[model samples]
Target: KKEKVDFIVLLTQSEPELNIEILEKYPEINAVLAEEKSEKYNFVTYVGEKPIVSPQGNMGSIVKIDIFKNKDGKIKQSLEFLPVDSSVPSDKEMLKLEEFYKEKLDRDLGTVIAKNNVKLDSGFGENHHARYEESNIGNLIADAYKNHFNTEIAFMNGGGIRANIESGDFRLRDAISILPFSNKVGAFKYSGKTIVEALEHGVSSVDKKAGRFLQVAGMEYSYNPKDEVGSRVSNVTVNNKPIELETIYTVALPLYIKNGGDGFQMLKNTVGTVEIDSEKNIDSDIFIDYVKKIKVLNPKLEGRIVVK
Candidate 1:
């Protein structure tokens, strides 16, 4: 007594008929089968197999990233597809992958900038404290120059502000953002030696990339890029009059520069210690008061750092 057996041969272009031995020789195919098995036994079987038809090997992947800003932040979602190679990717393929990564980094950086929620033309800290520090710090320097000293111009460094303020109620975190490093503020009296030496030190710092970009509350000067370093500054004026080096004028800057931190050695021994506040965090109070007074983007760049 014998029974009959039946076999079905499925044939179609939809699926490739692969010889088990030949397919095993292909490392890419073996990897694909391994991936399929691992997913099935994983803790969470969330996504199912959705193969991408490619010349090399089909692959599937999912990436999730979160982006936020201000008090309320938003999230963004995306999906990507890549072809798996048996070995290392070719040069052209690597270039394409690098470009994709660069775009991702740029997107993250933009997200960080937007979340700060401030209107300053250039700064690092959060919106509330950073803006307040901008207006207050500039005004503080100006007031010190006009009232404490007989100078009509005062300036600080923009890089002085380091961190950002947290929302609701601000604290040490906010102030740290405004003046993150241990740089102390100082007032110096110079006969226009302030701007000249500052520019010289600035040019010198071009090599080290550590110079504090100058932030001025009053006074103005134009530099000729075509001219030499020391002679680049021209038409320097305070209150509509030319600056006289022989006539001593008071200036405000961070102690980092006065102590020769950013390569300003000339100012190390020339500056005179004057009455001023120590390294303090007052941006939160200043910002809160500013918001209560007005709701607007008042800060604007007045050609402070121009490259033309």
Candidate 2:
């Protein structure tokens, strides 16, 4: 009670008022309870900043958790995340990530090829070429899955393409360095409700710097990043038609998004999901190889992702 009272006093703006019940019971807490209630509440409010909810502002940054049991037996976790912002240089973080990737690349040529940059001959122009090429790559991947494995839509992350290939030449290692994080493409079967929740989460997380980038092979959705959570997504279509919320939809997303990365915690809680591991699976690698062989790959907005 002494520590609690001290903490309360330290946090509040006004003096806390005390009820005499504790003094009546034990007679020892009267002095500790002399503070006014208003002060205590004000102090408590200032102890921690309010949680950020809007996409335009800084939502809570990524945090790592380390857990331990307190003396009172309540389990508490300390935030162990590094502080970072847009001002931080990418190279500072690049080397740390590259070292781990180099070790992995040593073992797998497929992974290495997918990460590298291969500048194809300039029969195709840049804008039309890249967008069409990426879409074609997406289509080929989707087609490959459809023909062999039972798959519906294939989705890729636009950010996965680290750099543009020049007409002359480029290194695969350069591409890998650009998109360093080891995220695999993932496919999942989900209920319409689950899909809605996932889209809502994804759209609401887009910041101005980090564009609401998502590549879809099937289905289209438009959402406003400025809108409140759960209200962002609108004009969703599947198979060239409006999406029916009651029907199940098979959608493809990066493995990170499926596992609750990028503020999509709803993905973890949603029920009845079948996630295809992109790393172990041959379908995704074959798709990438097919793209490389074609010498063209690019993705453009097909009215699937948007802002108000």
Candidate 3:
């Protein structure tokens, strides 16, 4: 019965063109079903006259293909999309899923962690501004690493902060949502010159919303956005003392940045690189612990990053 079918559908997340070529080897396969590269809904394209049906991820929609045989013995195909409405009432299976998720993820982890609201000033949660200037939430997150690792200076990439939290009860879910990545905390001994170079790279692409912006703790610096990229940062200091070019300062940051993620190549070449508290410590867990310890969390921008 399978051999008698007129259409062959291949479901995959790989490149569409490669899948089409593989399907062509089988002459019996007239039409191939595959997902769109862009994951756009209701998208249909032809690869060498073969109909390819692509569906969006997360079951965003159901793709329906209708094939018709013309009177002249030719075949024609059309597509339809059935979007998934999450607001619809749950079925029996969905109710079971709700129960499963609640048992696993919906437990009270802790009481209110902050007395005041923690602001997330990422240019209204936009990318470009977060990496360029000081943000309350950014400062808080960077402080977490600094405190946990007991480093002289710590900073995190602006892109690592995923969301903002209002003044209210803090939960494990909140921390998870904010620091979604599983980046481990890392520390290294770096010179003031290297620190300056890293900060220079951080602000190099501020106009493009690049993710390399450094949100720091235990140190502060002033920079002119209008200045040339490598020469923007100045007045850098660690512990209120001006950064000495010959001094090797201990810095704490995510392993992602330490390994040159987000263009932090200078960090990877630090004097003595070390992973703090083992690589098992996750970013979200550290942030959660910091909030729990501080209780009344209030992080403010105090010219840690002076942007003129």
Candidate 4:
């Protein structure tokens, strides 16, 4: 008698390309349980007779799968995505832990550091205008970085500004929500030509909701979207004077960009020269301290990033 196996399921959290490669290498695989998500697929995606499913159950959601064997010895499965929202019952122990963490977080993040006079926006998905246009939130972050680090210019990525802040009391949590990353303030010494290249890189994808869009302080620039990418940026100025490509400028930005995150290989090349007094201030804390010092949040779009 031979041993019987109806299904071979694979568990992986790799990229979709690797997952597909694995399936191709092992055609015997019938299903893949993955943490990787793709908006293109809903519920389940099939590769021939094989099915790929993602159990993003970390969000308190539940996934139930039922398997059955027919008389002919073929295995069939059905999947259900169960919501764990208000209808679901909470575990008492988990609830206690949640309460403990929530209490700690509220106490730590509840301090009102500043008062906002207007709503500052980052963006709203594809409809987000901050990607190509100047935004107050972007201005706020950039200004904070530039002023705190005492740099000639600061270039904060518009996409890094995640949420909007409304008028009234601004708390530490508000700052964290806007800049929810572990990245610290980083400064670089770069030639004026590299600054131009950075600005060009920032505006190169003006047609898409690209994260490379730079939110700036201490400079104003204009670009023609219809023009070619490398030459789109024009009329670059720092301190109201035209940018001199030969001059060295001290620039403040997130460490992520300094490390070539978001395809900024140009800035990445200029990483070794640290021109700032300190590089240990986490971005969120920097934003908070900036707000505390300012005491009022009144960021405005001052024609910093212009599109012609």
Candidate 5:
């Protein structure tokens, strides 16, 4: 014993394979809490003998586990997940704050920034989220990054897109809600070899619909899903030209990737990185500014990413 502890729970931001590896190595871990979304497991799921629980997406579900000691002193766990809808009462204080936010946005002078003529979706569906694939919303954000920074290429990971805006007015609040993170958009002078490494790493876990799946601007790339992870990416063209392995290209990205977030360790060795101030270059701010500058939005899929 672990000081009167009968069970162990692991909270992780890792993928399913890593989580499974952890459980395999540490038998004491009885439960795993992750951000992975699944349509079937709106409740609970079993991996081997342990149960994996998730909050799903859109903040609409929660898991409840009941632990009990049997007459023989063996521990047992029962898992159940419930949907969190309007039926559940909200905390008055929290509800008040939410209402205040809504009212403030509604009355704000800069609330409406632009008008979107067509729906821009990131492939995050209600029953199934195909967020890893290239999407029009992803391309739009990627375009914003590339254009704002004046770089040869830019990338917007699909997972970063949180919500889809139906065709209509694009508001400041809508930009914030769609790309909610405070991560700053920045750029680096990276060798073509490093770019290849980053792309390989990005699609390494595509089967899991990982957040690393990159949606790109100024580039068209293809991959073989049946190939091994390190060799999957190929036929990459930047700005209508084949990538030159010796060329140093200026690439724009969210600081999360440049700083080695989401397993992009290859970037740690990059040079001439021009990072913008976080407060001035936050993703939501960039998005709002870009939409306002464009004044109109027309998002579409242009075959930037092909899966063979």
Candidate 6:
């Protein structure tokens, strides 16, 4: 008697070379599922010696596989991938989903989070042009972090601010849309010298409108974009006092930055990092709370970052 074998499915987004090695190592593996590289909602399939890159259809996919024994007593396999559309749900399912959202997500909590005097600049789905300027939205977000954690300073990356806020009526969705990453708030102890280096790195790609541009609170500094990279930042101050190179200052920032996201290498290299549990200190939630407490938000371009 012979044993029956089952087909194997592998799901990954690794490099093509790595996928090829996996396919070579496992002959029984029939299909490899992954997100579409083309950024389209449609599903695409590539068959043959190379590893398969299956598209994750806009809503989802239903993959069906058939295995059977051939006349030669060898197993053969066939794959059927069905991409589901957003409207494929039954009427009953739609009703249930609507009810769930109404009970949980859609209800207005009757809370006014913050008031914006002017439309805050943001580049959520656009070119990310806010990374090159001292934006009112960025200032408000950094200030919220500083106030929430009561830290000496707070640093935020412009890339993290996903959407702009219009004047008046800031709701829960508005706040969530502006900071959708849900990164946890964290604190780190670093010397002023490292802080300056981090600032230099933040502005190094200003001409390219890179995401590494910084938005800060509880501290201010000046930089000349025309100056050479790594030497642009100067006149850093914390709490109305000039920063000392050897003095270690506590800083509040997102956990992503502490892990060196957006080229914040100095934050990652810091010896001790204290992360507030996400349940207790989600960035979006904290900022919402800060706004609710303050009632009115009037952040302005106060020369915190001077491009001389």
Which candidate number would show the highest TM-score if scored against the true structure?
A: 5
What is the alpha-carbon lDDT for the whole of candidate 1? Answer: 0.42
Task: Count backbone clashes in candidate 2.
Answer: 17
Q: What is candidate 1's lDDT per residue for 1-308, written digit by digit as tens?
A: 13421211122112122323334444232112111211112111111221211121113332222222334432222233332444645689888998998788555433222122342233342232222223434443233333333345555554454443333333333433444454445567666765667754554332222324445556655554455657655666666677777677666556566677545676665534455543342333333333333333234445433332
Structure candidate 6, residue pairs in collision: none
Which tens-of-lDDT digit does each residue in 1-308 have in candidate 4? 14557777898755455677888888878778876242222346667767777754334455677888999987788777776578987899999999999999999999888899998787643346777889988888998888888888999987677777779999889998888876777777888898999889888876865678888999999999899989999999999999998888899898877777767888876734555565456898888888999998888879998888
TM-score of structure candidate 5:
0.86
Q: Rate the local accuracy (lDDT) of all candidates.
A: 0.42, 0.45, 0.76, 0.80, 0.81, 0.75
Q: Rank the candidates by TM-score, best first.
A: 5, 4, 3, 6, 2, 1
Our tally of clashes for model 4 stands at 0
Off by over 4 Å in 3: 1-95, 109-111, 118-128, 274-280
- Which candidate has the highest lDDT of all? 5
TM-scores for all candidates? 0.44, 0.47, 0.69, 0.75, 0.86, 0.67
Per-model root-mean-square deviation over C-alphas: 22.8, 13.8, 8.1, 5.9, 3.0, 6.7
Quote model 6's TM-score: 0.67
lDDT leaderboard ranking: 5, 4, 3, 6, 2, 1
Q: Report the C-alpha displacement of residue 291, candidate 2, in angstroms.
A: 1.6
Stretches of model 2 off by over 4 angstroms after superposition: 1-150, 156-171, 208-213, 269-279, 282-287, 298-300
Better of 1 and 2 by TM-score: 2
Quote the lDDT for 51 in model 2: 13
lDDT of 2 by residue, 234-262 (tens): 88777778878688766655666667654
